[model samples]
Target: MTEIPAFKKNLPTQIAVLGGGSWATAIIKILSENNVKIKWWLRRKSDVDFIKKYNHNPSYLTDAPLNPRKVRAYHKMHDALNGVEYVILAVPAAFIPDALKNLNRNHFAGKKIVSAIKGMIPEENMLVTDWMEKVFGVPQNMLAAIAGPCHAEEVALEKQSYLTIASPNLQVAQDYANLMSCRYIQANPIGDLYGVEYCAVIKNIIAMACGITHGLGYGDNFQAVMVSNAMQEIKRFLDIVYPDPYRDLHSSGYLGDLLVTAYSQFSRNRTFGNMIGRGYSVKSAQIEMNMVAEGYYAVKSIHQVNKQYDVSMPIIDAVYNILYEKAIPANEIMTLRTFLK
Candidate 1:
């Protein structure tokens, strides 16, 4: 058991981000707006120089320039964690296993760790919080998940966005909500850790459904239907993982997020789905988007877990066929709709 360090007197409000990517840069902009200090740790010196010179990430978020004066970039993770009260992980879900490989779990030191990255590991099929607990021995009470419809592209533009900060601990949720609250960003504290994570995973599949519908030349009617059905499937799946997730189930966070993600032009998950619908292979869609379409990763993970628990997630199954089984997005839907109907 690692003992948490007592905060030193007069330490500034510092949040350390563990990955250097578009979402990280966007959140830094949002956090800076709240007058909080941010230290972003990256693996590359080029990113450091890019932000230092251009006030933006050239690789990930060139369109949304970061103000170098407002945020500091660090090369070493250790330097970033020093004196930081809260830590946010912003890397891709696939990279998490490797990210945790070198991190000093003790350095977390029982700090409030929030997962801004939303996806499940392929092998373990574990949510970010579950992965953290297994690998780092972090407690659920200290873990927070940021999930909702806000996009990095929109957040960078300083648009009005709402999200939920959730954990089993209400104070933990509130602490993140308070820390993340800003002029352009509104955050609501939520209590269901299961619902928050489930929403984060399921929205991508809904986005996939949207992409296929768009490719098939359908209008809002298809989107409306997809969103409704997707939520029902997510609720069913969550019921299997947590038999009583309905106790705190709120569509505002889950369904609202699904709605925006499925329709938003900036959604990588939806765009990735579009590519699959347009005959691009999954590998190629990944290439075109550059960012991990979390739903793509979750398709396999959720499928494996669903089988383990005998939980039926038709939307996840449709996405799995399109992404992994190389089924056309529209054809995949047709294949599933018959049995589902």
Candidate 2:
């Protein structure tokens, strides 16, 4: 663990972190290091009891220390969200509905909601911010999305990581970013919430594709070409969907995120895809990896969303076909090679 930095001059802000995954634990660790008050919600009562008693998450990031004075673990969603100004959504996209089923719009009223989820809603086929806006009635201005190349495993190791907080309201984004920044974490704010979020979702699919190819015994040269083509596909999709003239695909929020997810050893999406490429059935791969790979669900959502825009996303299509349509991984990937330059 890195040295904990001194608290900022202002009073600590009350924030709620939802989910019990590795990412959620990492976020708790970061907030604890910064001396922010955390109300962490986990589904299982046993896990909550363990975290509350031991001052650390028992399942994920067990070695990372948590501040008992500043952090409180809760099994009930209602209790966790109570009196919190900021709420960070770190749960897997597919499980979000079940996790918050007991809560209503009134529970989230006047709160700043930040999505640390990198995937879309599987059932609604909507971005998390969009889903929150429509389902929970969280206004666009109050919703922010976190993007960048940071991984929870590396954060546990105390590696220097950067995060981009995107919201339609820049000032609100900056204020939340302040609570997240610490000795090893640099968080910056941006105004392109939709762009950053859409790109973040798409990058996980691309990472899965990279993993599949690597598992199929494809060399690095081929992966470089595929990733280059993926950038173009992402640009095309973003142009048709969001149409931001000022958005830079080359930034750390976009390109940096895509590259890290595609190649990092810690990427669950890549690991899942690699299993598929190595001849494991989808069910078997999922069983082997107890963790959820966002790309599996994300590729399906992106495929459904792209029906309106009809963007030229060969890589996404290839992944969707393999994962959802039951197309052979080798055949789909081989057919995919013809589409890329």
Candidate 3:
């Protein structure tokens, strides 16, 4: 973690953080260590002032300190994007449309955009890439995403982590593969954007199932079985959606994420699932967790897409009912329906 091997090649001139959340703040901390200057956006001037004085964000990741010198806090999103060559979007999946509606004031022609957020879009049932293309009109060449076991809490501790940068555009993905590929954070660049998105979406769903297992006192062996089958379902959908273009979904971004999300203490999705498995209603889980679980978001969206694409994603269905219905828990998601059949 001393010298960034990736920085030896080239550095992005300026970085823009599009959200004021912990993930955005944590990334700003990482990029700042390389001496990269950043313009960060928070919705309120109060946040900008709080970050300036405290250096510690009280809302999320309070233990992590953002370098005041390296980060210029801005009151507006457009102001944050000013003079930035790269935009790191860390907003939640649900907030993207409205977030971008505010961002649409300025036109970004060539700036590289990277989505650090994971989960499916709710109303449109679209992935971030789909939204980016439809709303921002980002050319296929300019968009890239980071997915895998990258967690904001771990990144704050400078944990040695690995993730993949994927896009149809090789050069753009490589650019991020280059920036984020440091000793602590290893980057694997892949060319299949759809595969990466599906992996990101489905992992959240499986993590919820993992939570269910944990809550039920099913233990790790049951988790091992669920995750193994979860990957099988992910691969099946990926085969039909991406066909031959992408490699097996078991690569770190897909299965790797599933394992981490299922087991990690930081996974809100798993925690929420545990609550559900313990007989807490989905509404109660959401209220108690406070933090958004990407799995809860993915359940319905994944089910919708599965039906349309003629691919069966059963884990997603189980989670959807657990969250959205009064289905008896003893009978619902009893086991691997697809595999057992």
Candidate 4:
């Protein structure tokens, strides 16, 4: 076993947050409460200008006030990377490649990257960690993931929430966790970097399944069964992919995240699935919501990844069939009922 390094007193104080969505805004909100300097990268110059002038993001989490003195908003990706020791990536999974396209491996050489993204990279079907390693050469010890039952909506309201910072290097995880922890936000450190990241992605797909079932008028009784079964499905998949013997599925990083996303009204993935179950076409639901429902993309990616593992993920199959194959959500879910114990 590798010895965990002691938490260093002098840690990186300058951090950059990439992405302009709710989660990014929420993370900025937490950082604003602290005294550290922050750099924010948003794709739209309009949004960056709006945030700079108004001291708040114009679109997502508009209510969370930002301190202009502490945060410098940048429209260019490289500008945000300059002089920042830590980078927190909160962008949607699909947009990550484009977000970092302008920069090369040299850009991330010594920086610590903390991924707040919960979905896999589209088409590539790789976890953010894997993609980052392949594309940027960021070593495992320098990369970390933030997992949650923590929702950006609740965080904006300053409701108490928990987050698990997972990294192969426990010291890096602990250091990043300290940066994110605030009065309402509690951060815990864990060592299952791959497991936490993979579980985070899998839960989104299961949450979509939950939403689809709910939209089809399945009662609470059935929804409860669906979630319980989802837990087992998650464990089986994780066992094959990461294969950690001591990992606890019931931890806040895994099962807690799954339960909240599956049941919470703020989950965009669930909302997308609900629309599908209610007879809206996938394209229509996507257009109507005007937001990326990551699970829609994730199901296809996981489906491809699972071809090798052959895990018995009935819920995932049901979702993939409905979203990709254009199967009837009601009928597919009806069949899913028989597969779940």
Candidate 5:
């Protein structure tokens, strides 16, 4: 674990948390523990109204408290971001474009931007931080990403969880880390911005792969082998794409995050993959879950991005082939098993 830095206490007094999902509500719950006020932006006016009147999300994490006194819900992006000093984006990666469509670069001028999003921008194959910089003109130094073995469900339970705050600026990472730290959560900082984000994105795909195998009735023995190999695949991809000698793939930021996402019941990617393995069509599984799997989109993005480098990513290939190429999951996994050992 990297030691938490000693910096001037400069926590933002007000923050804008975008998105109306379970993750967004859980973050509002965390921030509600502190003195800082939160301006939460939900896409639907009904959901926003529900939070205001009932002090809890109507769709997700309804059991979690919202505390109307510290948290104010908004339907408009402009109203949510009006006077905030920091912005924490928690929406699904696929909806990010529409979420911020009404705003421009000027909207994020001096605010510290943190991505609670784990998946990359689809089609563009860009990390959220990179996309934010290019589209919103937010500087790299002002940006940070949150990676976790932590799940929103677990956070709502106040279960002990840890998060990695990655940024180009150590102090900036530390600053957000301090804000995110609470009794149930321990936030740490690292400077390997790209490495952390890429691993986070890759892990979802791995989790999907794990789910597919489990749904096929594969035993724990086989699942163990797949996850171990998945870690190696992540290391190779990260080493080639964003080389950092000091980055530890085994740390909580990398391997730990992957493990939880791959195995946890709360992982939507894993749940999505399981449905696929159980013979649900892609569209059907998506409709049943009614939540973004992330891996469903990320597989294609990573596949396209990996075309240039051509890393030996068998697990990723198996997922892409099954999800995109319409390859049989059983056949894909059988072939994938041969390459694992």
Candidate 6:
């Protein structure tokens, strides 16, 4: 375990969780366990009413019991943001723009922002931190990212999980980490904000590649090689893009995150890849899953971003080909196998 810095004094006590998905519910469960007060934002009035009445989310993670006394649910963003010092944004990356379309810089003025979103903004191809900073005038010191090998389903079950909180400000990161730590969850604080955030997005795309190969009938041996190569690929990209010499790719924030997403039963990205491997068209697979597989969008956005870096990412190319260019999955994986170390 990494040594945790001493908790900073006088950190924000009031916090709001902004989203209604499984991740958001998992966060609420952790906060509830700690006996913290949370103002939660769900999209619909009916969902808010249901959670308030039943002490459980109606749609996602219904089994995770919430403490209604500790949590208040609201349908409007502004209503949820009221009087909160830190806002944890758990909304899907693709929908973040539209979700905050009603508000401006003033809405976010005095709040510290933590992003639990592990994706790029689809329209801007920007990390959530960059999007928030550029669009809302939030400074880097005020932003933090939560990265994980941890999944919402496992968190809901009270299973042990680890999370890394990355930010440029060590004090702020440590302060937030203390809030998230509990008996079942371990929180680590680090300063590699850009690298960790980029890895969070990159791992989803690589997980999709793993899923595509799995769906194409490849076994564990091939997967082992692919994951190894994927790690090297991630290192290569982050080195060129973020260039931190001390960043450890093997940490839970990076490699562990890749392994879980690549193989976990709850991985929507892997499931999406499996469908494509089993002969489902991209549209058909997406329709069937009824969830946002971040990799489907990440592949395109990352591919475009990589053009400036010109990194050798055959796996990313293969996924982009299969997902966006209509290349057959079997053929793409066969070609991909030749490039893996």
Candidates in order, TM-scores: namely: 0.92, 0.96, 0.91, 0.96, 0.96, 0.95
Cα lDDT of model 2 by residue, 55-106, tens digit: 8889888998888999999998999999999999999999999888888999
Per-residue alpha-carbon lDDT of candidate 3 for residues 1-341, written as tens digits (9 for 90 to 100): 58768756464358888887777877776677664778888876888888888887768888888777777888877778877888888888888778778566255667888888788789798888778878878777788888878788998898988888998889888877877766688887888887888788888888888888678777787788778878888888888877765486667887788788888998888888888889998888889877778778777888888787877667777777777776655567674444533
The C-alpha RMSD in Å for every predicted model, in order, reads 3.5, 4.4, 4.2, 3.5, 3.9, 4.1
Q: Which tens-of-lDDT digit does each residue in 216-330 have in candidate 4?
A: 9998899899999989988899898889988999989999999999999999988988888888998899999987888988899999999999999999999999999989888
Q: Candidate 4: what lDDT?
A: 0.91
Ranking by lDDT: 2, 5, 4, 6, 1, 3
| Tens-digit lDDT string for candidate 5 (219-330) | 8899899999999999899889999999999999999999999999999999999999999999999999999998988999999999989999999999999999999999
Model 1 / residue 219 / CA error / Å? 3.6
**lDDT values of the candidates?**
0.80, 0.92, 0.79, 0.91, 0.92, 0.90
Error of model 6, residue 225, in angstroms: 0.4
Q: Can you write out model 6's per-residue Cα lDDT over 1-341, one digit (the tens) per residue? A: 97655674433377899999999999988877664679999988999999878999999999999887788898988988888888999999999999999989988888889999999999698999999999999999999999999999999989999999999999889988988999999999999998999998988998888888888889999999999998998989998989998899998999999999999999999999988888899899989998788888888889989999999988899999999899988988989989988
Candidate 5: pairs in clash: none
Residue-wise lDDT of candidate 1 within 1-341, one digit each (tens)? 97656764434578898888778877887777665678888879888877777777877767886656568888877888888888999988888888768776798876888988778877888888888888888888899999877888888778999988888899989978887888889999988887778778878877987897677666887567767777778877777787663444555577778878888988888898888777788888788787788888887888888887776677778878777777766777777666443
Question: 1 or 4, which is superior by lDDT?
Answer: 4
Candidate 5 Cα lDDT to native? 0.92
Model 3 spans with C-alpha error above 4 angstroms = 1-12, 335-341
Clashing pairs in 6: none
Query: For candidate 2, what is the lDDT?
Result: 0.92
> What lDDT does candidate 1 reach at residue 231?
75
Report the Cα lDDT for residue 57, model 3. 71
